[model samples]
Target chain A: MSESNTPRLPLLRFVYDGLRQMVRGRVVYWSWIGLLLAGILVGGWAYIQQLQHGLVVTNLTNQVSWGFYIANFTFLVGVAAAAVMIAIPAYIFHRQDIKNIVLMGDTMAIAAVTMAILFVVADLGRPDRIWHMIPYIGNFNFPASLLAWDVVVLNGYLLLNLGISFYIIGCHYRGCEPKLKLYFPFVVLAIFWAIGIHTVTAFLFSANVGRGFWHHAILAPRFIASAFCSGPALMILGLQIIRRVSNYPIHQSVIDHLAIIMTVALQITLFFVVAELFTEFYNETEAVMSAHYLFVGLNGHDQLVPWIWTGLGMLAIATFIGTVHPLRRNLLLLNVAAVLTVIGVWIEKGMGFIIPGFVPTPIGEIYEYMPNLNEVLISLGIWSIGLLLFTLMAKAAIPIECGALRAPGIPAGKLICRPEQQAPEYRKEPVNGESES
Target chain B: MTRYAMVIDTRLCIGCGDCVVACKNENRVPAGLNRDWVVERTSGAWPRLETEFRSERCNHCDHATCVQACPTGASHHWGDTNVVLVNPDQCTGCKACIAACPYDARYITPEGYIDKCTFCHHRVEQGLDPACVATCPTRCMHFGRLDDPRSRVAQLLRERNGETLKPETGNLPNVYYLK
Candidate 1:
């Protein structure tokens, strides 16, 4: 630290510093916002059209009612689960460097969940009637309804993350430490809740006995493993962008640490896929027939073949590129590999994951499902919104991270406090000696 | 006070899908959607194949998983009867029941409401049998009160070892199929 007698500036100068710093980062911030706005406008237009015309806008027929909406929901579950990868280390293992950065994951969780809810809304033909979901209004089926449980769990998880983010940010703004004593238990619950959202989603599909492909027993664990890869890859990509634009620099060690998690997650996902394939092909039972047919192409027309092959190809590329001696060592390549792994898993866990279960039909007929243009646009729009939300949050957060908005000693302007520090000794006093210190 | 159920004799079914078409027309079911369907499993190879058709719908299982899987209680068995119905208003279009149902009887409709054969509950309310039973050209489907010993369906069950789909799931489906 350089020794200087630079007197502390007044509140107005502090406010000016915040605005100037944001203006300097305007290129990066505005670009993200601009692209996001374009996507939302396009997506909103398509969604409005869909609402008027109904689900006919999508290629989904009765044979495939799920299509992209369910797939996106599945993908976002992985995103939500990935929040734990960061949380486990920082809160559970008490990793100090990750402590300050944990809030990023909290915000990401909120964004992921927002997208998931939006996808559900878009998937509905009559989103206006969503109020029927209100308990007792239409009828809450309770323990029998996993969807009801999903609604509860998802909303609960969202509120939990939002609460934590607000508490932490409020503390930071006020130059006080957040009261960890109160929020810690909830944080611990959020970790398990993190795992809960994905597991429940897997069970949502796995519970279908008639759909042989989805009935497999290992779906829950498979979901967790896949989420680990996709979530960390996405986070790594986000961090790389933050490092580039913001004055703050995250330790290369943090990136390397997350890379280890990506490696393990990818390996496990690959193993599960192989194991599932072996069970289907080797067993040769009528039950496994549809999965094999959809995955490897059964009766001359392999509609999903190219996409599935590409997913596997990308998986191989991700593993190889991510493992290359200098590439993993290099932040740029590591970021590239992370991007591949995320996309690869998205395809694998999205379509390759959901469609096969309905193939070969329950009685025995192969029906194909393809997403119509509107469906694609609406999905893209929701994703863009998530990115936009993350960007805005980071715009506010990155300044604090860069030390540009921080108070001289700690954070300033807010009086939030940890319980132990809430004692009279630590409370802020009047500046001109009108109040006791 | 009405209990709705169906009896299908696979031995007589010709895989014509007449019941499927009839139900759709009666229900105003959208095109490409089937509230009731016949799954034909063809055995043997090519020209020598022998096909077996099983007409399936919501069995209105005594322990219906669809009801259990519905997060919003949109799917439920009618009082003391073998009929499952969905309140469209209550459904969130989540499709959880579609996945939970082992029989593939549940379908997600264009309106995002879950749809399935309700044993023609609307018809039953009007003192009639399900349209599928009423319209079957082959007289392959029988509709009656299973609790009434005098009913043909009950007599048929006593005479034959009728089976329900995925009985092991313990859903206690009211619909019975005769081999």
Candidate 2:
């Protein structure tokens, strides 16, 4: 401690300082922020129009009640769950290589969850009545409803990640070690919670026995496998970007580890896809209609045929690149594989996953669904908000993690101590001898 | 113990869609959406074709998935009447019920809550038949209490060997089709 003591600023000041750092960035950062803001504005305008006109403004009809919004919501749930990949290895297994980059996973989770919730709100015919789902204030059919389970798990996962990240970053800012006791239990819980979130979401779809496409026993496991692939692929890409833009010491080994995880997960996801295909195609049943629409054109409606095939192609290429030792080692190829994996999973999990269930509607009516302009704009806008949030969170947390910024008590320009490096300092404090004396 | 059920004789149905129009007017359903619809199921090819006209609406099942799936008690059975009804005030319009209904009978109303065939519970309360049952030109639609053996619905079910749509789903639909 310094001889001349300076009173610490209130907790609010730390938050203000963090937010201020987000705005004072370079031209590229400003441009990115501007772009996201534009999306938000455009989306907000469309949402206002929807509010005045109701869900009728969108292309959604009674036949296909859930469209682009729910699809994105479902995909983002998996993305949120993907945080568990890093959290498990880093926190549970104590892998040092993964520890530094786990913050990025947590940050991604926060952004994805925010986007997921926004997508749900966007899809609601009466978004204003969302309070009806809130506990006590509204009737939450918890035990009986999978959607209710989803609401709990998603929010729980979000809070877990947010708390863990904030505590670690707060410790970094104050030039002290985060108490393991405080965050370790939460991290462990979060690992299970992340899995729960995705499982609950999968059950939300699968439990709908009405929708033959989603009513599969393998759905939850398939969700986890796909989440692992897409989440880590996104993390790998994000780590590469961070490594390029900042002084953060994102190790190459971390990227390699993530690639290996993605590769195995992608393989398992593909296996599940094939298994699902076999089950559906083995017999000519009414249940096969949705899968038929996905793989081939159902009647005259073939809008999604191209998209699903493209996703499959991308998945194949990504898996090939990810598996080969030399290709995996090559940074460019690895990045390409990561991008492919993300896009493939996005298509496979998003529209590709949601649309099939609606085609050949229960009454045997075939009404094709495509997102109208308003739906697209609103979706883009929500995505922009998520990106903006992630950008700001990353901007605030990264500097603290790198020791470029410190809390009020720490001297300016002093290097922040890493977790491993802080061990010796703790060891030097001879607690037992001092107590004995 | 009053189990309200409906029996629709597909053989007597003329594909006139009178029931659909009557139900729409009675419910004041939004334009471009339907509370009841007549589906034409056709099989075979060329000169030996067969077509069947079936009237479809909310099944008001013994185990209604919509009621089960509703996060709020918005979609529920109306006591002994056993007709599935939506409490507009409680509905959040989350559309979980719409997705859960295998029959695709539910639709989001202009008011933002789900709207479906309520078995004309208002008319039933007045000791009158549903608008569809009353206006059916062929008198193919029959609505009565299934618990009473003397009720027309029960007698028809016993005589005609009536079958519920998608009975394999185990929803135990109250609406039966007299083949």
Candidate 1: what lDDT?
Answer: 0.76
lDDT by residue for model 2 (A1-437), tens: 44343345646767987988887878877998999999999999999999898898999888888889998998899988886657677766777768878888889999999899999888888878888888888977877877777777777777888898998887777667789898888887888888888888888888787789998999999999999999999898887777666656666667777889999999999999999988898877888898888889888889999999999899989999988977887778988999999999989988999888888788778888999999999999999999999989988887788787776768544443331221221213333233211
Compute each candidate's TM-score over C-alphas: 0.87, 0.93
Question: Which candidate gets the maximum TM-score versus the true structure?
Answer: 2
What C-alpha lDDT, on a 0 to 100 scale, does residue A360 get in candidate 1? 64
Instruction: Write down the lDDT that model 2 would get.
Output: 0.85
In angstroms, give how far residue A76 of model 1 lies from its true place: 1.3
Q: Once model 2 is optimally superposed onto the true structure by TM-score, how far is the C-alpha of residue A337 displaced, in angstroms?
A: 1.0
lDDT of 1 by residue, B1-179 (tens): 44445789888888888888888889999777787878787799989988888888778776777788876666777776757788777777666676667677777776767788888878888878789888877888898888888888888889988888767666778888998
Off by over 4 Å in 2: A1-9, A411-437, B43-50
Clashes, model 2: 0
